[model samples]
Each structure stands twice: as C-alpha cells, then as structure tokens.
Target: MDPLLLLFSLSAATCAYLLWFYLLARNLTGPKVWPVFGSLPYLFLNRKRMHDWIASNLCSTGGAATYQTCTIALPFLARRQGFYTVTCHPKNIEHVLRTRFDNYPKGPTWQTAFHDLLGQGIFNSDGDTWLIQRKTAALEFTTRTLRQAMARWVNRTIRTRLWVILDKAARDHTPVDLQDLLLRLTFDNICGLTFGKDPETLSPEMPENPFAIAFDTATEATLQRLIYPGFLWRLKKVLMIGSEDRLKKSLQIVENYMNEAIDARKEKPSDDLLSRFLKKRDMDGNLFPISVLQRIALNFVLAGRDTSSVALSWFFWLVMNHARVEEKILRELKTVLTESRGGEPKRWMEEPLTFDEAEKLTYLKAALAETLRLYPSVPEDFKYVITDDVLPDGTFVPAGSTVTYSIYSVGRMKAIWGEDCMEFRPERWLTAGGDRFEPPKDGYKFVAFNAGPRTCLGKDLAYLQMKSVASAVLLRYRLSTVPGHRVEQKMSLTLFMKNGLRVYLHPRTLA
Candidate 1:
C-alpha cells in the first residue's frame, strides 16, 4: 500500500513539472521545444537549412518588428535554460552591435571554442586583448603600403597562376571547380600579404599546401565545437578521438608553418603584416611575444582567406544564374576600361584589373554587395551578453545568454529591405542615375561587412581583391555551369558551396 502511494506521488510530480515546462516553452516565439532537448531536436532536423529556418521563424513571429527578436531553447547545452536570442531586425542589430557594444563580448563559449586554433587572437578575444590588436591592426590597415602590397599579390596571382590555369581549362573544354580555384587564389594572396610568403595553392598543377589544408581542417573542427555542446567536444578532446584528434594534428601543422614564418620574418623583415607587427611596439614599448604574433598572423589569414573567396564564389554563381546582372557588370567594366585604356579590351584582359580600375567599377562593386546581401560569407555571428538588456525591438536578453545576429536573415527580411529583398538587384545599391554607388541610408541594414565600431577593417582591401578578381574573370572568360551539377550550401561557419561551383570557361570575344 505504501509503495503504490509513493509511485502515484512521483508520477504526479513529474506531470506537474512537465506542465510547468510546457507553459514556459509555449510562451517562447522561436522553434519548438521538447522537455530535455528543448529546441535541439528542431535544430538538428533543420541543420542543413539552419539560417533559412531561423529566418522563417523570425518572419512568422507577427511581421518584422513584432517578433524579429526570437529566442531558442537549449536548456541542456547552455546554462539557465540555454536561451539563445536570434535577431534579424535592423534596430536590434544596431542595438547589439553599436548601442550596446560594450555589453556584448565574444563571451566564454566563443573564446573557448576558438581558443585552441585561434589562441587569444583579435577575432577570438574581447576587452583589452581585442582592443590592443584592433588598434594596432587599424593603424596598419590604413597604410597605403599595405593596400599596395595586397594589390601586388592579387594581381600577380591572377596574371600568372589563375589565368594560366583557366586558359588551359578553356582550351581543354574541361569543367573546373571555380570555388576551389577562388579559395586557392585568395589563400595564396592572403598568405603573401600576411607573411610575405606565398603557398602557391593556386598553381597550374593544383597542389595542396600542407599549411592551407591544416588551417582549413582546424577551422572546420573548431566550428564543430560551436555546433555541439561544450561538454561533448571537451570529452572528445580529452579522449583524443573524432574531430578533436584531427584538430590536434592540424594545429601542429599550422603551428609549424607559423613558427617558420615568424623565424624568417625576424631574420629579414619585409613589408608584410607579420613584419610590421614585429616592428611595432605594444603599450609597454615591448615587442609582442612570439605566441601573440603567431595568433595575430593566423587571425588575419582566417579573416582574409574565406570571406572574399566565399563571397566571390557566390558572386560568380549569382552572375551565372542572372545573365542580366552579368551583362550590366560587363558593360560597366567595358565603360571603365574604355575610359582608361581607349577600349583595348583584349590587351587589358591579358592582365587583371589594376587597383585603380577595380575601384572605378562601381556597378561591379554593387553586384558584389548584392551577392553578399543574398549570401554572406559568415552567415551568422554570436555575441555573449554581459548584462541584462533590452533590444531595440523590446526583446530582453539576460546576462550570460547568447545573442546571434543573422546576416542571412537580415538580407531576406521584407520589412527592412522592400518586398523584392530576396531578388538579386544591384540597382538597389545605386542611385536613379545609376552612375554612382549609394548604400542604404541606414548602415545597419546592409551589414555584410558588419556595422558599428567593430566593422571590418579590411573592407576596402576586400573590395579591392574582389573587384580585381571579378573583373578579370568576367572580362576574360564566359562561364557556363555544367549540366546536372547541383549547387547546395554547406552548413559550416563560412558559407561554402557543398558541391563546389563547377563550370566550363569559354574565351570571351570583344567585337
């Protein structure tokens, strides 16, 4: 009799607890929540289309402002019910990025996830560490010499390796993976600018550089840490198994390469970022330690390689799909070239577009911006809340909670951009005259380069590299997507094409 009564009491308590959980979960505006799993099941199910899923959730929450700021339940993975506030609203974005900038840092989870690969680098650190690196990097990015160095590297790669490979592919009528090509090209270019050493990953032979492979492997492994819970990855790391094991090996290769580069720079200084950092003194008038320099150099490489290459990959795919946009870009390029070189298309096409010429292609830049609007390289970013605060849309985020701003979702929100927000139209970025490029009035709306004080310092250099590459490729060759080749998005930290962009290149004739 006593045992039966105890069983009944326990069942009643469990039912009561479930009811309480349901009541609180039903009040949340985001994805569905189970008892123990919270929204983990939904997140897992929609993993491939995670960004679009978040955008759908935000859109369904009563127009834009009514529920633009939504929270996901991950009670098990995070502390205090594991609520993650995801926002796509411009006002909320402004609030989190600028208005409450100090209140949001990289947070422990972010820093810890990336610490192994990135160390205490600028991108992975917060407060004074990030500030010092930012101030130092800002000073360097502003120098005319850095831009010139970047241009030299980009142009040389295009003129020698990239063009050579593409020309051979065109002659052979072979389909090439354009995404891989761009990744290699940007890898080589960034490596040169970062350490004055070129991995030459974009050679005609298409060799794989150990450092590049290791860097990519480490990045992917690091992203896995963010996707899964911290404890699970930590256990794997301790056990020396799975992705963590691969990460360990990759880090070794990367460290070796970086150490070699650092040693080389010390022996004979160059104008690369590493050399500059070596010469510059910190606050105490002391040289940055070897570990700090290595991390800083790795951070630059990480930032420079994937973003522009991924953006260019999407830009090419978009232009291939939208012939009208491609034609407009070509027309703009031709006009600029005609003005610059008296219409010697063939002669100029032999070499990549110069920095001056690339800057003149306003329409092309607009197209690249439009591409980023549709497909940002870093689709979403996470920030840790330092204090309890309310977003512009009135959504409250408590301390220790995570806030994610979806760049992908922001570009698709009709309330922010117009009904035609989903469409790829560079004209939106131009004035009525269509001669000059004009960004949106509210800088927060187009945050492909991010907004506020932490905005990308490499914005100008990124544009220079993208414009040079895009103009050179479009002017020299007409790309056609291979039949039966599928283009799908890869669910990773960077927006990469899962199947890669496969296309055949045909020589362009200028009549």
Candidate 2:
C-alpha cells in the first residue's frame, strides 16, 4: 500500500473508534447528549432564556438527582472534557455545601474568577482562612453595639437620604428609576455603616463617584466570567488581553478607595464596622492585619450593598405589579406603626424596629419572602463534589464534578411549591394559623440567604433595611410603573434589573 493511503486509512479508523466510544458513553450517562457538541447545542438554543431552559430540562429528566453532562473541545487535548451539572435536592446540597464541605472548597477556579474583584475575602476564601474571617465577621455582625449602630444608620438613611430623593422625583413629576435609586441608597448606607464615611450616592445632584462607578463595572465584568470561565481569563492574562485591563483598573480604583478609608479609620478610630473589625482581637489576642481589614471592607461592600438593594428593587417591582398586595402591605405597616406610636408623628426613623416590631409585621415579612422566592438576588450557587457520594434520593455524584443549586428554579418548582409555583402570591407565605411561614429545612428550599453553615450573617440586617426603606417610602408615596417600561433580568452573580425600573411616584396626602 502507498504510504499516504495507509495514513488516511489509519486516521479514518481512529475517528470511527472515538465516535463509537462517545455514543456508548452517552447511552450510559442518561442525559441527552448531542453527537460532537454534547449538550452545548441545546444550551445554546435556550441561551437567551437559560434558567427556564435548564429548569424545564431538569423537570423532564426527573427530579432531584438527575445528572446532565456537557462536553467542550479544547485545543492541544485529544479528547473533550465532560462537565456535569445538577439541580436542587436538599440532601445533595447538604453534602456539597455542608456535610463533606471540606472536600469541595471554592477551589482555585473560583478564587481566580473573583480575585480581581473580591480578593481573598470570606466570599472567595476556603479552609481555615475562610473560617477565621467568617468567625470574626459573625462576632462583629452580632455584637449589640454594631447591630444598634447599623439599625440607626439604616433607619436614618431611609428617612432622610432615600426618602428625600424619592420625594424630589415625586414633586418634580420626573419618572424615577427605582433600581438605580435603591442601588445608590444601599451604596451610601453600607459605606456609612461600614467605613463611617458617606459616598453621598443619593445626593440631589447625583455627583460622579469613582468607587460606585468602578463597583458597577467590576460586577458586570465578573458576570462575564460565568459565561467564559476564569481559566480562559488566566490564559488571556498571559497575553494581557480583553477585559483583563479593565478589571485591573476597576480593582485598583476599589483598592485605592478602600486603603484610603482604612487609613482614615485607623487614624480616627470611629465606631463603624471597619473600626470594630480593626480593634477586634482574636482568641489569641491578635488584631486583624491591614490586609485582612481590606478584605473585610471589600466583602462588606459586595455583600451589604448588592443583596439589600436587589431585594428591595424586586420587592417594589412586585408591589407595583400587584396592587392588592401593596394594599395589604400598607395596611400591615399602618397597623404596626400605629400600635407602636400613640398616633404621634415622632421620629419614626430614629428608632430601630425591634425584633418584636419586625415580627408584628407578618404580612410585610411574607411579601418580602414571596419576592425573594421569585427573584432571589443570588439566583444560583455552584459546589464542586469533593468525594463520591450518593444523594438522599439515591443518585450518585462522582468526585470532581460541580453541582449547581438553582435557588431561582427551586422557588418555582411545582414539586416544591405546588401548582401556582410561578405566581407572585405573597399569601402563599401566610400559614393557615395566620402567622408567617417557615421553611421545612433552611438548606435548599429557602436559600435566598443561602443555608447551613454558610448562611448569610447579614440576613437580619438586610430584612431590617428593606422593611425600613419600604415602609418609609410607601407611607409617603404611591409608586406606579412608568408606561411601556419593560423590566428584564440581567444575569450576574446578583439578579439586577437590566433596564432600570422606571416608575412615577405620587405623593400620598395624609387623611
């Protein structure tokens, strides 16, 4: 035989063998696998509506432990790499997030993705380092003085800063973008509470602020990483291309502002969260180092600002769509406030809403819960399998695979939430006994603030902040959606409104 003919024959045979192997493996895997692209084609078909696409697939493929795999071709590699993805199953989530948590650290992959923005903060760190930071944060967050101070600051921001902006928009008959306003308010409030310095984001003129600008840019760039993984970025970093330069610039802006704030706080020693974190001594009596302080400050900026703002923005949007629900919330707010005060127009914003006060507003809490159910700010979370384990439902997850829990999808699951799962009904959260609803387990179902050991410590503070702002604003102004304004979701680590939520605020007159 000719040498060229022999070579061609050999190549054809090898291709045939690999094709047969892939088809055989696909049959065994139980997930719908396309020939060469695997699941990528299907995913691309529904890329515009990714969450719904995945949810529908999960539903059809059977609930809980159903596994799906996707293959991506890489240059210099002989065979394609298989990546497995899964949906919400409490026990499976528990195994990944809590039970064998040590085995499944955030890993270097996530650290690289978030490092340019979050650095080595608790949100990205793992192992003993994460534990130390979490412990210190929890201690500071739950401290009486810090809690009291935060409450006061949140209430004051709601009353003075936030309301003033809304009032101006209402009076001038200018349509307000509630999403942008909420973001600004939360940024200002969190900055004040954490660093004892105001960014003045809610000012009348809305002056340009580099920190806020960079923060928004950083968030958008971080979301891009989800579509293209960080390893790809690391490769690009080698060549020094694409958004790498932009990301570096944003990080520098954030770091410069943080370092300045830290320096000022160190000199002044005020009673903000940063000051407390700086002065806080560990069990071994060592103060948090400057690097740790910077990490903590950046973590607070990410956590404290985005979560509350996103939640509040969604809550208001829900209220606008559901007027009857808004009526119920207003009724509940009135009853609670009236009972709290003896019909006196005293300083409502100066005092913190006590745990008892928060409890009394059952409908308000329910409304917020329903909002979170439908539009969780942190829509999805991923956990990589550390060890091979069988889930409660008896599905086996192999080691070195990533499992994603769709908090957004779980909230809308018919199996979990009944037939009306997709509806934004606040009444679903009201118990038959007329009390606020509670989850069966805090891990997967009600995972808006996450669950188990890594549950968000700022959950209570977030609720308080949202309630204060909602009550204060709704009592004074009636917000209606601006005509033909389409509100859509932007896919990011945080669920933000793609187009700002434009609304007309009509000031309510006291009867």
Candidate 3:
C-alpha cells in the first residue's frame, strides 16, 4: 500500500474503534462516555470541581457505577488502556481497600509516576519492602527521643518563629496570606526535623528559596502525569521534551540539596531525625545506605510538607467564613489556656507549651477534625485490581481495573453525614455530653485520614501541628478574612484555596 493510503487506513480504524466504544458505552446504564475522549472530556469540562462532578455523576447513575467501553488516548500500553473508575460507596470502598485487600495494589501505573520522586520509600513500595519500611517508620515515629525532639521543634517554630512574624504583621495592620505563611512554616519545621537545618522560608522578609520552588515544580509535574496520556508521556521522554527536562531539573535540585545535607549531617552528627535513622540499624545489623536515607528524606519532605499546611490553611479559612465557629474555637482556646496556666494568660516566647498542654485542648482537636472532614488534604487515591473480584454490593470488577475513592465527595455525601453535610458545622463533631465525638470504628464512612492498613501514619503528628499552631496564633491575634476575597478549593493531591487565603490579623488585648 502507498504511504498516504496506509496513514489514512490507520486513522479510519481509530475513529471506527472510538465510534463503536461510544455507542457501546451509551447502551450501558452508567456514566456516559464521549467518543475518543471517554469521561476525560467531562472531567476537563468541570476541571475546577472535578471531585463534585464525579460524585454527582456517580450518584445520578446509581451509587456504585462504572463507565464501560471507554477509550484512553494511549491504547498501546496495556496497563493504561480502558480503565474502570469507581467512587465512594461504603461497601465498594471496603471491598477494594480493606476486604480482599491483597487482591489490590497501588499498581504499576501509580508507582511509575511517584517512584521518581519518592524512590523506594514506603509510599511507593509494597509487599515485604512496604512492611519493612512501615515497621521502621512506626518505630521511629513513636520513640521517646523523636517525640520529644518533634515537640521542641514544633513549639520553637510555631510559637517562637511563626507567631513573631504574625505578631509584626498584626501590629502593622497588614493582611497576610495564611496559606503561604503556613506552607513556609511547615516546610521549615519539616526540614529542621528531617535534616537538622532550617530553610527559614517563614521569616517576615520571606527570601526566595530555590528548594521550595523546585519542590513545587516536582509536585506540579506529578499531578500533570495523572491527567496526561501515557503515550504522550513516553513520547515526551523519548523526544527530549521540555516537560520531562523540567521535571529532571527539579528532581536534580532536590537530590543535590538532600545529598549535601546528608553529607554535612554525617560529618557532624546531630540529634535530628535523619541522624537518628543513620545511627540505627536493621535486624541484619546493617545501617541504611545513603541512597536509602536520601529516599527516606525525600518521602518525608514530600509527605510532611504540603498536606499539613494545606489542612491548616483550609481550617482557618473555614473558621473565617463561619464566625460562630470562630467564637466557639476562641472560647475553647481561652478555657484551655486558663486551665494550663493556672488562671493566667500563658506567656509566649518566654515559655514553651508542652505537648500534653496542647493535647488537652479538646475543642481545638474537634475543630481540626471538622476541618479534615471538610477538606481532606489527599482528596482522592487510586488502586488497581490484582485479581478479578466481586464487590459486596455485587458490582463485578475485572482484574487490572483502576479504582478511585473520593475522600472529598465522601465528606459531602448526605447519606453518610446527614442533611447538613455540605455545611461547615463543627458541632457535628461534638457529643451530646459536649465532648469531642470519637471517630467511628469502620472509618470508611468518614475516611478523611483514610481507613484500614493503609491509613495515614502521620495522623497524630498532623493534629499536633494544627493544634499547636492554631492555639498559639488564636490566643495572641484575631484573624478576619479580607473583604472580596474569593477563597475556593483547588484540586491537587491536596486541597488548597484557589485564591490564596487573605486574612487581616489584629493583636488581641486582654481587658
């Protein structure tokens, strides 16, 4: 055949396949599919509120639904072809994430995207490797020495450094973007704990930091991979494309910085987390290699940095929108402080607040939980089927299908959370006895921190960070939203404000 004829024939076949897929999908009574694009076009149409769009589509087409006979752009890659996506239905989630869990793994596609950034760390590994990493991480996280170090580090950073900057802004009657401030604060604190050096991006001056920029670029690239077609990704890699080049540059910057920090820490040992890991050995009596240490550091930086900051940012935004909630939080803070300081206003900067003191603020903890219920940092997560399985609801999912659980949508589901599910009501978290409501045993019903064996390991640490920061700031300064600021959620791995949260703070005076 002539070259022109061959090219025309290939295009004709692709169009025929797409047309057949559309007709076949339309006949099935589930989520609708568009020719050539499948549900991707619908996702792009409502990219801003993709989570809500997916949930609404799922609810409209029965609670547990799938889009059959869809076409992904990349048909050559067997693993990336014709994926089946699922949303949050309790039984469905339980089947995939908990019951018959061994039949589902994070899958090769997911690992490929994150492996470059996280290496072989816990977040990217499975089987014996995952078990080993999780066990080691759990042990280190719960140690008395590490716990004490983390407490001291958080107190100094939040109480001493961050509040000082916020105090100055308040005194000057300046509006601060709490989102940016929280990111810097968490980044610096994570760095100090992990590497024993402070990036100091949280300072009032706010110097331009290269590591922060590179880290942001890496995260953006990872998100892009989620939406882009697999063939395009591979082609870009082969063609020396700019997107791949930029990703490499960003990763190089992070790697170089981590290597230098590891070298410095090795030369002069410190009591930081990295040093502690370096000093300890596995059951084989062999210390973790530098490469493994680097991988661990990368995982810590990526996992610990954005999620907490984003969560706290949303928490403050929710409080600002609901004044009644803010007043209740303030009242709780005052009561906790009074109890802690023996009827006196606790002095800041001069004395560090103990972890026990921070933990005693029951209302503060409840407020944090409510914030998580509204805006889970990780809005959704993906898994792939390893074996053909039937859900408890009798929805048959074939092997190699992709499954997604929408944490954000689950938070807003009326069937799960009652009629005021969409409202920002912290009282929902309060018991009739006026104490904080304990989370349910089967957490799939309210899976902000996720449930089962894969639940977040840093849940306790995150709460501690939020309570400490919120307590210190709310006690000393009153924050109100800037007028005309449209704060809406952004859809990334974590939920952040589309427009950065702008709030004006005024120093509170004791009467």
Candidate 4:
C-alpha cells in the first residue's frame, strides 16, 4: 500500500548521508581522501605503487603530510581512525628519533601486530624491556669474541657452501636465483652464529628449509597487518582465517625451531650467542623462560638473516648494473688482496679472509653503504607520539597519533640527497680525499640502520660479513642476472626483491 512512499523515504535518507559525508571529506588537503576510508581510496588504488605514491604526496606538501585512514561507520559515529603523520623530512626524522626521542616508541599498534612474531623481543618491546634487551645485545654485539666468531662463520660459510654452489652453477651454465643463494648463505651463517647449530641452508643442493620458509611467510603476513585496520584484522584473527591462519602456523614452525634449538643448546652448552643469552638472567635474577629465550633467538635470527642477505642481493644487483662501479670495486679488491697477501694472488683466494683482511675492503664497504642508501632492507618504520609534539618541519602531532618515517622515501628525497639522489653513485659516500668512505654525519640523514640510541647494534658485524662475502664471490666469479628475469620488491618486513635476483655466473680466471 505504501511501496512508492517507502522508496522515496529511502532515497531521501541516502541523499542526507551523502551530503553529510561530502561535507566532512572536503577538509582533507593533499589527496582527495574519501569519507570513512580517508586516504584509503587512493591508497587502495595505488597499493602496488605505495612507495612512489607516498613520495609523490610527501613531495606535494613540502616533504610532510597528515594522512588519515578512518573507519567506515556512520560519519559522526566513526569508531576509530588511523591518523598517520607521514614525513620524509630529515629534520622531522631527527626530531622524532633523537631530539624528542622520549616522545616516541615502537608504540601499541606495532607491538600488537608484531607481538606474535617478535613478542617482547628487542624489535617489538618498548620501555624497560627494550632497554634490557638493548643492553644485553650491546654486550654481545660489541664483544671481540662474537666478532671473531662471526668472521669465522662468514668465511667458512662462503668458502665452503657458497663457493661450491656457485662453482656448480657456473660449470653447468645454470641460471640461479642469486637472492636465494644469498638468503641461504646468510641463514646458514646466522643459525651457526646465533643458535650454535648449522642448518646447512646454503649447501650446493639448495634444498628447502621449513624454518626459513616459515620465517618468510610470517614476516610477509605480519607486514600486511600494518595496512589493515584493527577491526578487520582482529576479526580475521578471531575467526582463524586468511593471513591470521598463515601467521599462526608460521609462528608455530618458528617457535618450534627456536625451542628445538634451545634444547640442543642446553644439552651441549656451547659458547654461541644462544649460550651467552642462556646464561643471562632477568632483573629478578631468574633465568629467562623458554618463551623469552625463543624471542631472543627469533629476534637475532630475524635481524641477522634478512638484513645482510637483502643488502648483498641489492648490492650485487647495483654493481652488475654499473660496469664502472664493478670495475672500481674489482680494482680495489685486487689492490687490497695483493697488498694483504704480500703480492700473492693465489694465496689470497686459497686462504680464508680474516677480520683484519676484510677490514681493508673500504671500497666494498662504500659500495654496500651506497646500496643501503638506495634500497635499505628495513625501508620503513614508525613511532607512536606520547604527547602533543611539534616536529622540526613544523608538523603538529597530537597524542595517540602515529608517525611513520620511510627510510625508502628518505633516500630518494632530492631535498636531502640533492639532484643526483636518484642516481646510484658510491662516490657520494666517499670523503673529499676520495679514498675513504664517510657516512652522513647526521644520524637521521643516513637512517638505514636507524639512528640515535636505537642504532643497529650489528652495524659493524654486518659490514664485516658483507665485505667478506662480496670479496670471496667477486674473486671467484662474475655474477650477471639471468636474462628476462624480472626483479621487483616483495611487500614484507624486509625489502626483498619480489621476483628474486636470478643470475648467470661466469668463473673468473686467476691467471
């Protein structure tokens, strides 16, 4: 009896809601952020191109912008929102990371998302927990003992596992995913250094390791959580579906591996990183529980594994692209090796590269640093604002707001790096004398390993490891990418080359 009247009423309600949403959405300045979804409409449309999209927006607003992702509820009744004050400004990076350091921490959002994987580990925890872990790590990382162990591990792994694999690939003329080889190398090296166990992940056969596979799965899934809202992800988590399911099983695999490693360490009690960690107790003088030990293990594994492998993969890719860079690196390598070995080229290849010898590869270190500048493994990270704060760039961040600084975007910013920022040039890092490599004086400017008190503890070790591998590989073989193999970045906690770095290897003759 009233069908026509009901239809008119429904139409009028729709018009009212549209008018209300339209009024609220117009206040957004940078992009046409839609109501409820905020910047997500544009973000969703450009998900594949996020790094560039974000850089484009940051460039539009003088290198800073207030991006919002609101709940899709009724306009006035919006439940919660994700207000990301994203900045690519270096001054703002210093302000948040150093000058006003106390104002920011990993925060609840990051901790919550990474909790399952990282737990109260160094990367996830804030406050006292973070301090304790940092101190403990500082102790382990700075030790000459650990550095010696790391050098042995790297040299042995490269000479034994990596060399044999590449030799086979070169002999067979087989195309290999260099990224996979590097990942295996790092995984084997880290597992031996950290767990007092060797997974032998870099063997010539290149078989799959479940722990490595699961680690990759869990990290990528968790990275996805950063983009999803709490409600949507929390509901998926509750239902045991989708990414949550993958995360659940992956963590299970990772935790089991950790526990198994711990048991082996306890039974044997060798002097690896795990043994050192095992001996340390909490502030209460009680030995850490298995859970704590697992986090420690996972934390170190995560740090030691991805960062070096990803860095090397990118470094090799960059070096291959620039013949001049490769030639310069080779010349430096020959000079350093010949000089170090008393002009004995054959002995340089035959003998193991020690810490003292690797330390002399200044140009190699410079090349790696330059690669990190353009493509940092951990490209993006964020902090939570504790109180109302004014960034150095004059952006106002309110309490309970989130601020994410993209190291990826920072490296590409012309304002900080000059007009040639886009160009891959290792010479930029070299000093005026053009002989020694000098990093940016400001922490925030070269933020690949982070900055200030939270600087990466493994920085020195990373350099030592990368230089050793690069030297060993270059002395034996010339690596070129497999033709028609696409290289792209995988969306993950680490800046992994999505398609993997596939390469063809040609053996270099010492004669």
TM-score of each: 0.96, 0.90, 0.91, 0.93
- Greater TM-score among 1 and 3 belongs to 1
Instruction: Please provide, for model 4 over 1-511, each residue's C-alpha lDDT reduced to its tens digit, 9 standing for 90 to 100.
Output: 5999999999998999788877655543456656557666776787676776766776666544334333343554332246677776778888888888888998988889899999988888888888878898899888898998888889888878888888888999998888998898889889999988899888977789999999999998888788767777789999989999999999999988998999999989886888888988877778888998899888888999999999999999998899899888888878877877767677878856787888887778888988998899998888988898887766667777688887888778777788998888988888888788788876577888988789999999999898888888888788888888888887778888989999988988764
Best by TM-score: 1
What does the lDDT come to for candidate 4?
0.82
Give the whole-model CA lDDT for all candidates, comma-separated. Answer: 0.87, 0.74, 0.75, 0.82
For candidate 2, what is the lDDT?
0.74
Candidates 1 and 2 compared: the better one by TM-score is: 1
Residue-level lDDT tens digits of model 1 in 1-511: 6999999999998888687676667666677677766677877788888878878887776455323122333333333326688888888889888998999888998999999999988899888788888898999999999999999999999999998999999999999999999999999999899999988899989998899999989998999888766778999999999999999999999999999999999999999999989987766788899988999999999999999999999999999989999999888888888898886767778678889988888899899999999999999999998888888777778788788888988888888888998999999999999989999999988888888878999999999999999988988889999999999988888999999999999999875
In model 1, the worst 10-residue window by lDDT is 66-75
- Tens digits of per-residue lDDT for model 3, 239-329: 8576676778898998898998899899988877788778866557788888878888878887788888998998888776788877877
lDDT of 2 by residue, 94-182 (tens): 66677777766776656667777777788988877788778988887887777777777776766667777877888899998888888
Order of quality (TM-score): 1, 4, 3, 2
1 versus 2: better lDDT goes to: 1
Better of 2 and 4 by TM-score: 4
Better of 1 and 4 by TM-score: 1
Candidate 3 off by > 4 Å: 1-31, 62-80, 279-286, 346-352
